[model samples]
Target chain A: AKSVSISVEGMTCSSCVQSIEQHLGKMNGIHNIKVSLEDKNAVVIYDSKLQTPVTLQEAICDMGFDATLAD
Target chain B: LQKHEFFVDMTCEGCSNAVTRVLHRLGGVNFDIDLPNKKVYIDSEHNVDTLLETLKKTGKNASYLGEKSAQ
Candidate 1:
């Protein structure tokens, strides 16, 4: 498994954190996820063959938050 | 069913929830939001203009992205 970190914008409260984590977790290939509302970022560990940064970003978008690969 | 698409500028879960709330109020509509792409897809019997107006009422700048109706 490979790990990737992403920067997110406009997350407020624990509910936001939970929502993002829960939605992304439902996607296949996502093995682990850590979202920090304070830092406005998420670290995800997943199967490299099954997911990509773009797909991860899409999952975040699906939950209604802006996300991009962390620089 | 008709498929309508819109581009909405949303930054967080709260914004998405707002969108969902408005869509639900529209009645006979179900939606899928694509946050990174800033888009929302709706399956409904309503026309595009009503959906566009409803999204704007959420205080987020939104635009119609066309519509497709399934036979």
Candidate 2:
């Protein structure tokens, strides 16, 4: 599993956190996910062979959120 | 009884889209959404409490910023 972290903007409460999580959780090959509203970031674990950071970013975008892969 | 504004936590264009989608799903309520400002204006005659709870269930935090009489 490959782990990647991305910064997210505009999360104000726990519900916002839950929304992002619910959307991302539906994607295939996503092993685990954690989102912090206070920190404005999300960490995702996935299979590199089956998925990539770009794919994750697109998923986030599709759900109406911004995500940039952490350096 | 009135219109209200909320400062929504949205990250990008996608986030705005998601917020709009959720609000639109609520039957019989009208919403004026501003993506750039991350805000929503709702006009409804239904119970505000029900509306607020629906927003929360969709992963958005909404605060009552008072109301204005319908013009």
Candidate 3:
């Protein structure tokens, strides 16, 4: 598994954080997720073969938050 | 433009924020989010399917509740 950090925005509270984690967690490749509302970022661990930084970022973006892979 | 009512399972401010962002990102929408009621009323030129798809991006269960008369 590989860990990636994604910058997330527009989260105003814990519910936003939980939604990102819950949605991403259900995906096939994602193994773990931690969303920080104060930090405005998500750290995700996933199977390298099944997911990529871009895909992880896009998954979160798909959930309506602005997400980008951290450099 | 038509007014559409939709049910979104928004439980908190963050959930509502996600709705606001997705609709704003999709553009051509003027929406009102009622978090307490888990409802969203939107005025838009987009089709119901498109709007529902956009709302679902928030990772919330969203379904169209039919159109509302334009005021």
Best by lDDT: 3
Candidate 3: which pairs clash?
none
Q: Per-residue CA lDDT of candidate 2, range B1-71, in tens?
A: 56866666655554565666556656677877776776667887667776666555434455666575656
Error of 1 at A52 (Å): 0.4
Q: A-chain TM-score in candidate 3?
A: 0.95
* Fnat, one value per model: 0.11, 0.24, 0.78
Give each prediction's DockQ, rounded to 2 decimals: 0.11, 0.16, 0.67
Q: Estimate each model's TM-score.
A: 0.55, 0.54, 0.84
Best by TM-score: 3
Clashing pairs in 2: A64-B14, A64-B15, A65-B15
**Model 1 scores what on Cα lDDT?**
0.78
For model 3, the docking class works out as medium
Which interface RMSD values do the candidates have, in the order shown? 8.0, 6.0, 1.7
Model 3 chain A lowest lDDT segment of ten? A61-70
Rank the models by TM-score, top first: 3, 1, 2
- Residue B27 of model 1, lDDT score: 85
Model 2, residue B21: distance off in Å is 10
User: DockQ: which is higher, 2 or 3?
Assistant: 3
A1-70 per-residue lDDT for model 3 (tens digits)? 9998899988887778888888898999888999999889999999999999998888887777888876
